[model samples]
Target: MNAIQFITQNTQLDSKSVANTVSLLEEDCTVPFIARYRKERTGNLDELQIGAIVKFKEAFVALEKRKATILKAIEEQDALTPELKSKIEQTVDTTVLEDIYLPFKKSRKTKAEKARKNGLEPLAKIIMAQRTTDLEFTAGKYANANVPDEAAALEGARHIIAEWINERTDIRNQIRTQLEKYAQLETKVIGTKKDDEKAQKYQDYYDWNESLSRCPSHRLLAILRAESEGFIRVKISIDDDRALDSIDRKVIKSNNACADQIAMAVEDAYKRLLLPSLSNEILKQAKEKADEAAIAVFTKNLRQLLLAPPLGEKRILAIDPGFRTGCKLVCLDANGNLLHNETIYPHPPQKQLREASKKIASLVDAYKIEAIAIGNGTASRETENLVKNTPFKRDLEVFVVSEAGASIYSASKIARDEFPNYDVTVRGAVSIGRRLADPLAELVKIDAKSIGVGQYQHDVDQTKLKTALDTVVESCVNSVGVNVNTASESLLSYVSGIGPKLAENIVNHRAENGAFTSREAIKKVPRLGGKAFEQAAGFLRIRDAENPLDDSAVHPESYGIVKQMAKDQGIPLTKIVRNTAVLKNIDLKKYQTETIGLPTLQDILEELEKPGLDRREKAKAFTFDQNIRTIDDLRSGQLLPGIVNNITNFGCFVDVGIKESGLIHVSNLSDSYVSDVNSIVSLHQQVIVKVLEVDIKRKRIQLMLHKG
Candidate 1:
């Protein structure tokens, strides 16, 4: 099948839609741009659907490339029979194609090759035919200088037959099918390391055996991790007797001495060749499935975290809480620019709570701080208590921001460039403050993996993980429009077509030529051609621009349609923007053209009604249980308010005002079967969970979602 056909079949999308999407992808159109702007051509396919087409299209291309390589290799050897070439060309499954090419594949010398050189192939064929009942007589005829005795000749013939049995596609497929359906993945602890403290984390996997087909992705990844860590040995197995019998039924032709010889060869092939190769292949497929699953979980968590509620532009006091070292505090303006920085020891050896509180209050009043953001890290609880008790002249909202990747951000090159004169602590405080103001903008600076909302992210394929995470970041950044004038280069880079170089050029241009007052002004940036502008224009918002739609999602190309609507209404553009009555009365059917369909027209109308509207919700203040400061103070069934910090395939981790986050397993998420943990809770979701059990020694807490 062609790429369009393959994508249509695999994704179950309409063939026409798949073809159109492929064309757009081939034309270098970004997924977000095509989904948002070119919906009419794609049959209104969403970003996820477009992403699916991209994935399957790449797979088909890879398959075709592999076929060409295989065909060329076989042709070079003059072994490319018409039937074999036809089979290779017709098959799309990579496994089946590899099986067809296995016999022709060049490799190092083997026993079978040695036997063939010893002139034992004729005897092996005769034995395989099963026509001669006297195998010893037949073997003696083939015995020569290389094969000294009848036994040695028969053994050599058996080796050649063994290679033939291994090369038979049907037998290999039979064993592979068995392994896929019935193989058991077993793990056992290394005796010498059983008592090691680190190994205790994976104790549940030690001496464990489960059906490979039935094992969940999380468990399999854990077992693989344990094996990688030298804590255990993993083995994949199936019933050998059953596999041998299946192969025997397929290969053996008659009930005679030749049949016995064939059976022996079958046994040798399975034990020495097929089982090991097919078993590893099956296991690799399982690991791939697990990697995809883990990456999906991480992608979802990262998306939700990136699009988490933004406490829009607000001047604030951000604190990186600590103990004996003192809490590092920075005062940031509404734009998140650090105006001042200082350290105050509210807790620890100094115990200068009065002085710290006074300093914070003075800074809030001095800097006109609108909100107080405290990092939920070391000494978070104590610092929170101090902030709660501090006297302020005006009511201010206080938020505890997740500091998961703050440390990584502190030492990053982006942070250094942004705050060249500040230390790591100051940069960390700025990140916490900026994260509260706009999550999508600030989180894009740090690597998504360091954000800590993943399951086995480091264990999965890093390249795939990075690609998936970057896709999510791009989707989130574009979905919520960026203010082009104020956005950081890191944030701008994720804006559809504006990559690192273009982002740098845009930043440099803005620095040289003031804020972008109109979308047309952006085209002037060096190295930013028309295509980049086309993909990124709608998603880049310009505040107080000459044209009102410049700040909205309405693409500049569609400005004429919007202007005609305003002209038809006999009203100015400003009156049409955000004017619900005018927007509602505007008939979208009148604006639909050959290129602009109902989908694009409807999007334009919505963008007009709420220009530059953020897709994320507004941030709110949440307080955890004051009495529950530590794990030791928790009791069974004690209700507590928490925020989900991380989510995985198995469960989600909730921060409940302590260092150790509690886990709400999939089983405890609901009484019914919970197929997806995300369906019940999301990253940074405020939830009320009851303590089910607490293992203070292990620093583990089990929680159940409270219905109330």
Candidate 2:
């Protein structure tokens, strides 16, 4: 199939639309660009469908190329027959194809290859035939009377047959499939030799065993970790009776004597070769399963971090709370502009409390600050109290922002570009402030894994976690349209068709030319081709532009259609946008096509209904208990308000005015069966819980959601 036909078949897209989208995507056109500017060509396929078509096309091409390469390699070795070539061509999955190719793959010497070179071919073939005709007579035929005896001849024959059975790919695969289905995984702890302290964490996993198919991801991961630390050894074994029965049924069912000999050979081969190979395969599969679970947790955490409620476009006084080095203070304007910055010594020798309070008050008054964002790091609570009690604007709200990954971003090149004249500490404070204003935009600039959202994030597969997190970020960023005039280069780069360098170029162009008055002005940005504009223009909003629709997510390409709709309805564009009545009167059937479906038309109508509306809701102020700041302060049955720090597959972690959050296990999330934690709570949500238990020495706290 051609690229267009293949994409349509795989993605379930219309043939014409898929063809047009592929043509545009291949020309380096961005998803947003194709959806917006290339509507006529692509039948108005949206960004998401276009992206899927591109991914499908790429994967299809790669698979086709790999198939060709494998076929060529097999042909060069003179092993490619018509049937084999047809099978290779028909195979779709890479793994199955590789499996079929395994025996033919040239490699270093193996036991089977060594036996073949030892002049035992005829003897091996007789043994494989499993003839019932007198075993001694058959054996004597291959015996070299001067060089080898009957017993020696039999031993050599058995070795050769064992090698042959092991090398038979079909038999090996059959046994492997049976073993995988019926295997029991066994784990044994390595006995500690008195002085070994390294194995303490894995002591509980010393004798753990479970069925291969039923083991939990976390439990499997824990066992693997134990093995890695030399605290345990894990092995998977299949029932020998069942395995032997399968082999006998396949090769020696009718002849009793033949069955016995074949069974013995099969047992020998499994013990010497297949068992170890299958063990490694099971372990590999387990590791992948564990990695997928870890990635899922990290992905959820990343999504929560990205979607954390924005503080809106308000002037903020951000303080990176510190005691010894003093707190880093920064003032950001409504549009995230760094208005002023300073260091405040509110704790220690510079404990000039009056002076510090006066400095903060002056800055707040000068900048007309609407809120105070304090980094939830060292001495954060003290800083919050200091700001709250100080003589500043009475209406200014103080919020404790999670400062995770702030340090990473401060030292990044993006930070250096955004604040060339400022120090890293100052830049971090600004980031903290901006994060409160627009969490999705600012957090995208930092590595999602470093944002400190999930459990054991550092121990997971870095590449897989990064790919999943990047997808989540991309989805969230695109879901929320960006402002062309106000978005930072970091946020703009995530826009469809824009990368870091291109984003920088766009920013540089803006800097050189001033604020963009319309989306069309982006065409002037260096290296930004027409394809990029087509994908990116619709999502780039220009507030207060000459065209009112530019402020909405309505694409410029749709401007004419909307204008026509308005004119046909005997209403102006502005009137049609504000009054839903006019839109309700227009006939949407006229806009339907292969590219612009009813979905697109409905979305356009909705955008017109609510022009320039902020999709994100305002985050409410949270209340945390003042008395319970650490585990030592927590007491049983004490009721306290806290913030839901994170929600996981297992439970929710609540930061109930304590250094270490307490987990409300899935069982305890509700009186009823709460299968999913997300159904109950989300990240950064305020919740009330009662301290069910606390061990001050162990630094552990147990919380109960029922109290709330």
Candidate 3:
């Protein structure tokens, strides 16, 4: 049907909201802009709902384009009929459209084409009609030079009938429905790959059989991966007798010899054409389903990790721990500017504990370090102990930060531009420190896939994954307003409308003209037009702006509303913006205009309550049990503290003071049944788990929730 009708049929969203959202999308309004600013027009649709509408509309448009191409092709062949054109135009499903186009599709010479060339059409028609007639007599009527005898004519006729059965839309659709409900996936290991080390990782999938419709996404992806790598052969199968019966019922009419010949043609069509084509189609559909599920999981984990608690602006010392290479250290100021860098060896090769301790103390005193952030990598536990034991001038909060993509960031082009003279080690240390101070700001510089908190990140569709992760990053960045004065180009890139090019322009403008004094100054950046300004102004906060509302989530377009409210209340704008008591009593209905609704006004009131408030929680220092340092140190039934590092459909991976993170399966996430792993545990949640099984040989550990 139409875009609106298609989207409404697929989604449970309000038809009016979907229509408005589709209209705004057609006008090229971004999702964030509509969700945040145009509440009145979209019926207060959130970004997620708006995004879904845009997705569904795009899918429908693509289907329409494909339909147009097919209709034109069939018409060019002089084979298009009025009824067929109506079917193609009215239908939205791609599979149905393809089936209707199959007969007209040009292909190389096949048995059906050859049979028609051999004057066997009359015999094929006899078979198709399934009338009370003698097959030899019907075949004799078509016998010619191409068809030498009655038997030869009968064979060619059967081939033509087989093709006709294959092209019928009703029969194909019936077979597809059966496959969707009953198809099973089976994998058999290649004899030569059984002993290969890489193949061993997928041993569980070898000789596996499961219902394709019921298999978990992770398991399906894993099996598909193994099959792709030549470790196994995956096949989709169903009851052959039932499939033959389905085609038979669709074609066979009379209980005679002609009907028996039609039945044989159905079997031939299934064996030669229909079965292979539909099996591949079903596999592609299953793989796409698995990809979507994996991408959703990846996006959720990335969102939680990006929005993890931040340890607000503070001078800090960060360490990248190592055994043979010494711990690389850097001191950063409150703004995350690198102030000092050094290297100290306190473990293994050097073991100069006193010397390293004195160096750290001196650096802390000299730089006025408020916190210490250590990377949880090789020798992380030992370095943490050393830092905690060392005497300093003030009480310092020590944090063990995940160093998943620190090295990638260190060697990145952004890092090179930011710190041209610093080495990778120094840049890595700085990243660890900055991530603790602000995760969204620091992690934006690194690729989400490289951040290493996903399931099947590499296996999913790359385009879909990138789009999803980019959306998540944008959401988190906009959720927490950026400081226009001090945010780096990388952090500014994720702002609602100011993408990479504009973010760099903003950084250059700031460099040339000094810090932005007001939100208005942003429009002066090169190539940042009015539309970009409208989309990004509210999310960019100026701490000491001339206009008090500029520092909050209130958009510039609504500044007059706030000022009017202040004038009506007989108070200065500055005082009224933060005066909770006055804001509480204000009647928001008085300000409702043609453009502004209750939803937008409610958001403005909330912003006034807590201006420029960070949505993330405050970072707290977490410590693993002192007794546990390595896998060798873990014992069964010992309770220990851990952080959920990565979550998958099956379970979460927790770091419990060892290089090998332990698995807490979905079953053990709590005392109750957990259908969803994320509902129970977040990316960085602190949990108390008891060691269940630790296999030192495999470097694997199993953990369960601590009862106490």
Candidate closest to the true structure, highest lDDT: 1
**Which pairs of residues collide in model 2?**
32-535, 33-534, 33-535, 33-536, 43-595, 43-596, 189-206
The TM-score, computed over Cα atoms with residue i paired to residue i, of candidate 3 is 0.97
Worst 10 residues of 3 by lDDT: 132-141
In model 3, the runs with Cα more than 4 Å from the true position are: 140-148
The estimated TM-scores of all candidates read 0.99, 0.89, 0.97
Q: How high is the CA lDDT of each candidate model?
A: 0.93, 0.77, 0.91
**What's the distance in Å from true for residue 529, model 2?**
1.3
- CA lDDT, candidate 3, residue 135: 80
Candidate 2 local lDDT, 595-671, one digit each (tens): 56666677788889887676777766665776655677777888788887776667888887546879878777788
lDDT of 1: 0.93
Q: What is the lDDT of residue 203 in candidate 1?
A: 97
Better of 2 and 3 by TM-score: 3
Ranked by TM-score, top first: 1, 3, 2
lDDT of 3 by residue, 420-528 (tens): 9999999999999999999999999999999999888888999999999999998889888899889989889989888899999999999999999898888889999
Expressed as tens digits, the lDDT of each residue in 331-420 for candidate 1 is 999999899999999897999999999999999999999999999998999999999999999999999999989999999999999989
